[model samples]
Target: MPHDLNRLFPLRPARVHEVCGPSAMSFAAIASARAQGDFLWIREGWQPDTLNPVALSEMADPARLLIARTANQIESLAVAEEALRDGAIPLVVIEVTRPLDLREGRRLQLAAKNGQTTGLCLIPEGMGSNAAETRWHAAPLFDPGGADSTLMRWEIIKNKTGTLGFWDVRWNAAAHRLDVVSPAGE
Candidate 1:
């Protein structure tokens, strides 16, 4: 019986861990999930105008992405927890203003593992614990066009999967995709 259960439900790979810095971390996460398929996006204080409509449209077709906006952080987390329990979505990405504590994060992690889903918690700069598979610190990067423009660069601070760190990525808000950029001098 145990062998049958194991065969029916093989263990999943460890979720990717990453720490984002000062760039389009949210967009990057969304884009990545969209490419993979079957993911839910729980946005807190998300502004539609801030996202690139074309990019969002491309990846979110045919029910590839689901967006559920919440009134506050607690509501967002609660909704995420519920979704994880339902086991309907394969990935859940949440945007939060404050980092979750170790205990709460562990609970969420367990739920994700049990549900065979990936839980990505997006928080403000310096708003997460070591408990998360990957803790990302994201901020908007400078846009040569103008301060109001949406082009951004993101940095990856910590990656639990391996020693991968400090990635500078470019985001096209219009396309809602991430690209690797050359160094400043290059």
Candidate 2:
């Protein structure tokens, strides 16, 4: 039987959570998912020397998680591709400093379709592209904790699968999870 993409995917309740930096929300989104047990993480060859040890430890624990780390962007993408092929990971998140062209985006989309995975590209703020199923522009929310705080508000710029609008989403840095706040019902 052919896989049912629609059944597996839903726009209404937005299963996929994303958090972008000033450049790409990939890291934030991945970090949040890692905290939530969506998929195992593998950081490729781009480990920063100044990474927070505490944060790293929390994200790497295998008992409450299935996250792993690689060494670079290429390796990370490869691992994600393999996971999709094996049906181990249904969602793959990638961060791109530069905006992807239609061809490249189409290729990634096709790959996701074939592997039955969702490819999420984190682009820089104000970076416009017509390739993704949805385009979101996110910004950090006000936090009393200080600059290191992870609270954020996601602005949904464009969503092809559902209504073209935005929603208020909060990321609890303590819980490392996202919660969508509902508007006041009529």
Candidate 3:
């Protein structure tokens, strides 16, 4: 079995991990379970917050989730960079509608790595190029079994050290664990 997110896809602490596709938010919430500690969500203030508190409560400690608003991508990234370096927060999820330059991207990785924290960068559709250690393109798929479970269909667009594969993500609220279900067709 894959030991860490790196093996699962291309996620690692101290590296910029990009998540895209139609269900990026859902993917982000599910992926966040892999990382522990306080959560940091950085996004534009203008955008509506679609995070479901009850659903998140089933995954991580909902009380630790913090949402920060920024005026632009630069500030959001800058805040993310600083937060990653603190080492206090374990997971920093940045919602970006724009692309980051190489230097800024590198800084995010370095900061996260130096602080031993996980950095999850969520990029919306048509916002920017997928750039990171691993880029996950995901969309929600109706459960074939007609259960209440949510199946997150995803493809590893860019995987540096992991094999390319597709899987359906199912979150078990009771167990609070993420299970990779049968691989779905593209």
Candidate 4:
């Protein structure tokens, strides 16, 4: 994790974490950018939302991304699990459209731990009662045209390590990193 992210969200290595809400992908991308080395990203093949290379390049080298497009949710999970288990990549992010069952979550968790890699699941809706190390909900704080367009809020809804809180943050485009505006309800 990057120094700035470590301060707000200290993620444990060799564990699976979840990111929920509409901005989940963006949040995941930002975190992945901070992470070192090449990474694998698994997403549904039919999903309309495509990642923009230009936007991604602002945070990190876009060429370092290894993308895997799957036919369905099941395939996505399978690919993610296999990638995590391989332990070659430093980070693995999967776009999950459905909630993961306990067994599925646990499998991913174990794979991550065994491989000594970090896994981030982008869940459209929050995953419930799973083996994830932490669950974060991310949302934009304002519209793009607004004065605080870059502002966003990330809430740590669940954590196995006992840390819980939310922070108002903004992306510093020039700095290519997240800047904490305020620690909400700390």
Candidate 5:
């Protein structure tokens, strides 16, 4: 059976979703790369790590990426909310170092709904407490026997639809997107 990403993951538009774990950034990148057209990615200025253009090119068109760096977490959230409310971008991704409170999460939810845009929040592992449409936990899957180290394990920790599952996925360079290698039995 074909593992349709949209059907398997089902990231609803006009809602904010959460991605947490060691490879949360990668997982968020994969989602953005799969989306059509350009996207906005917001990060804190304090974050020393920068998004690699070449690396992003593997799954997404780096030239279409628009990045915004905020001076701090508060600024980052503000920018994200504004971008999300603008309804111009199809996808808005925000990397947050701290957990989002209930009020903050509600604000994002309203913004996304108003703009009809999808928001992806990259959070630290085990630090999610938001009203997200779905919450995903991603981690690198070690496969010493395999040559590729990009393999990842993903689990749906929370879903509004009440669907929960896990899968082993990897970036298909040839396909220019993520592919589910196998739907691990829950």
Candidate 6:
């Protein structure tokens, strides 16, 4: 079950989470679905058209989404930091092109801790150093079956614990949940 899967790697309330790789957006949607309440999405200059209201409506409630558009990564992070302070927003997703060093990363972590919000950074490959408690790599897999659900792969590249692994997850749109299709995709 999704609940059982979540227990293995639940998102910490006061921590920075990173979703990266070729298909970071897909992973962000999956992570967002697991969140409890409304969220704030901060889009850097790199992704202006990625925030489609119609598409978001399918994955999440468009009305509950609060968007902050910034000209640069610094500005986007600033907006995210402030939004993270609001405890009402359980999740804050930030899209950035560049990597974040430890110092700046610490600030984000602290803000999340103070507001008890979950911070998720959606970035592309070669992000260099990341201070997130957990780092994930997401990609889509070819599903010849053409199943109703989307078949995706998730790799826990880095985490607080020493646990490292990957899995094949199915995005069941009808149920609005992620199910473990295969462990390790072996």
The most accurate candidate by TM-score is: 5
Model 4 C-alpha RMSD vs. true structure (Å) is: 3.6
Q: Give candidate 6 misplaced runs (Cα > 4 Å).
A: 1-4, 8-10, 46-48, 183-186
Q: Tens digits of per-residue lDDT for model 1 on 29-84?
A: 44454445567777776545344545555435535667788888788878888876
The regions of model 1 sitting more than 4 angstroms off are 1-22, 33-35, 44-55, 58-62, 138-152, 170-179
How does residue 145 of candidate 6 score in lDDT? 68
Alpha-carbon RMSD to native, per candidate: 8.8, 7.5, 2.8, 3.6, 2.6, 2.8
How do the residues 112-147 of candidate 2 rate in per-residue lDDT, one tens digit apiece?
A: 666665555555565545656666666655555457
- Report the number of the highest-lDDT candidate: 5
lDDT of 5 by residue, 79-180 (tens): 999999998888999998988999999899999999999999998877786588899999998765469558898888888766687788888888676767
Least lDDT summed over 10 consecutive residues: which range in candidate 2? 8-17
Estimate TM-scores for all models: 0.65, 0.58, 0.87, 0.88, 0.90, 0.88
Global CA lDDT of candidate 3, please? Answer: 0.76
Residue 18 C-alpha lDDT in model 1 = 31
Off by over 4 Å in 2: 1-53, 56-83, 143-150, 172-177, 181-186
Instruction: Report the CA-based lDDT of candidate 2 relative to the real structure.
Output: 0.48
What is the lDDT for 168 in model 5?
83
> What ranges in model 5 sit over 4 Å off?
1-5, 8-10, 183-186
Lowest-scoring 10 consecutive residues by lDDT in candidate 6?
Answer: 1-10
What's the TM for model 3?
0.87
Write the residue-wise lDDT of candidate 3 on 110-183 in tens digits: 88888888788888664444347778889888776768867887877777766666677777888877777765
Better of 2 and 3 by TM-score: 3
Off by over 4 Å in 4: 1-10, 143-148, 183-186
Candidate 3 RMSD computed on C-alpha atoms after optimal superposition onto the true structure: 2.8
Model 2: how far residue 39 lies from native, Å: 3.4
Model 5 earns a TM-score of: 0.90
Determine the backbone clash count of candidate 5. 0
lDDT of 4 by residue, 41-61 (tens): 999999897999898887768
